[model samples]
Target: MNNLKGPVRVVGTGLIGASIGLALGRLGVTVHLVDADAESALMAERIGAGSRDVAGEPQVVVVAVPPDHVGAVIAAQLAATTSAIVTDTGSVKSKPLVDAGALTDDLSRYVGSHPMAGSERSGPLAGRADLFDGATWAITPHEGNRPEAVELIRELAETCGARTVELSVQDHDLAVARVSHLPHLMSALAAGTLVDAPASHLELSGQGVRDVTRIAGGDPRLWTQIVAANAPALTTLLERIRGDLDRMLIALGKDDGSGDITNLLMNGVTGAVRVPGKHGAPHTDDATVLVNIPDRPGQLAKLFADAAASGANVEDLRIDHSPGLAIGQVELAVKPASVDQLVKVLTERGWVVHR
Candidate 1:
């Protein structure tokens, strides 16, 4: 926090930039907002993100523009601002560095950072103050980067309620390609299957399809730039998936039920279970207790209160609404030992409990 001692200037007022402004503004820091789109900057300011006025030289300048524009903007800002650490929140790191290198040889004051937090929504209107809470922010400091500048960005991340992780420029690009870019592409590919699907077939779709294609709703233009920027890593991963898909197809064509498809499916289960659970920790074999909740005000609050009274702490939960139905199904995840007690208590309290 001490590293972020002075005023900050955010060069873009999009979701990430506005959210950062909102978070830092709450911390009693003087934040100045700017954007190529004046409307965006004004909207962010109206939302209490920050002020549009620039009083003096800011301590740090945050570049929150699109991935393609990050390098030039950061380069220009680095040259324009005196003694200010320039950092960008671009999802891809390596390409921006390459672009910035072409523009200016000096990068001693520039650090690349990416916050692993966002939604499918965009613009200042979709900005949330707590978007970065409990999120991991990657700080990629290259050779010749100033240690003091790196520390300033690290402290800035902490001030915004995010944990910091260090990664090299190449490593950051590779890691994000695997986890972030690949998933978006996969989701878009899956969702693309439904583009021309028969209306009858699409009507039969369930939560499975929705869950699988959720990230596909993101802005395609932005994603296209991201995918192209990290094409080398993404191509390798996509080839692996294609190989697996080809194997499954070959297995399906055989009359004899070989274990190829079975093994492939089982591998999916193993990988899915390895996905981190709440708070980015290792997954737990938590028991789920489902309760049918009526669509009524205060019903959810009451249910939670009852769960608290039952002395069972729910670790995690999700609510699924049945289309055209007036009720929702609440799945409360708890420690395996508390499942029985939770079910018993909810059932006794007139909740339609399901295992």
Candidate 2:
């Protein structure tokens, strides 16, 4: 990996920016934190992300501001820095490229990149050094960008511990619209239905609903800016979904015993299975085994130890807590071939195990 140049200035010390600082700090690179909000910058500095008082001009300036303000900041940073490569962490790339291009004739030093990793949490306090570890970072370099500058930005991403995928500005926008923005909108729409839901309905909530609604808990203000920035691409996706929804409604309205609804559901199953699993491998039909565990310390540890002892590598797991109960159900996903031995070991160990 090419070593990152000294004094990388990070603007807008929010979650993404601060995380970059922390990740770069792990590489022993000098990071200068800057934010419009003094408190945010100060908090980020206090957490050892970087110092706000770093001297000397920056070799690279990262604009991690909200989507709406990305272009103007990129333009400003490009104008302010003599030779520093300007890169952004914005989700949408085309808008910023256009926005920055409008303000300046040359975008040679400007590259757009997006880190495909984050929590629902925001702000500097929510930042961490390992945020980008093993995560995908998309780099969208416009035609006008210098090759060396683009390569430096790629090095910066690697230094932050993320793998890089290069795409065109328009291509990056379209890709994120399908993978990120569209899904966020779907999650929000599904979560919206539960706003006025009765307590009885909520009482029946389980891991499935929680999983679907998890990303919906993000800041709405941030999402509004993001979706609006990529309106063209996102609108295209939403229209396709609208067609499916109309078909679903038509199927529901008919009692003709047609298989339209079942086919639509089957389409979802097909797409779900095509989704990449851990380490970007093809999805697998891992067998899940549920174990009733006592709600006490060391119970989970013991379950894990027993599962390890069974010689079945636990692939994935989810814990579903029963309301007002002293027990939790752990759903463990393991290979089908290992399920029998896993179950036998757990059952022999006196665990309340079930398929």
Model 2, global lDDT: 0.91
**Each model's total of backbone clashes:** 0, 0
Q: What is the C-alpha lDDT of each candidate?
A: 0.90, 0.91
Which ten contiguous residues of candidate 1 have the minimum total lDDT?
Answer: 278-287
How close is every model to the real structure, measured as TM-score? 0.92, 0.94
Off by over 4 Å in 2: 323-325
List model 1 lDDT by residue over 33-143, tens digit each. 999999999999999889999788899999999888999999999888878999999989988888998999888989999999998789998888899998999999999
Model 2 residue 85 distance off true place after TM-score fit, in angstroms: 0.8
Candidate 1: residue 207 lDDT (0-100): 77
In model 2, pairs of residues that clash are: none
TM-score of 1: 0.92
For model 1, what is the error of residue 149's alpha carbon versus the real structure, in angstroms, after optimal superposition? 1.7
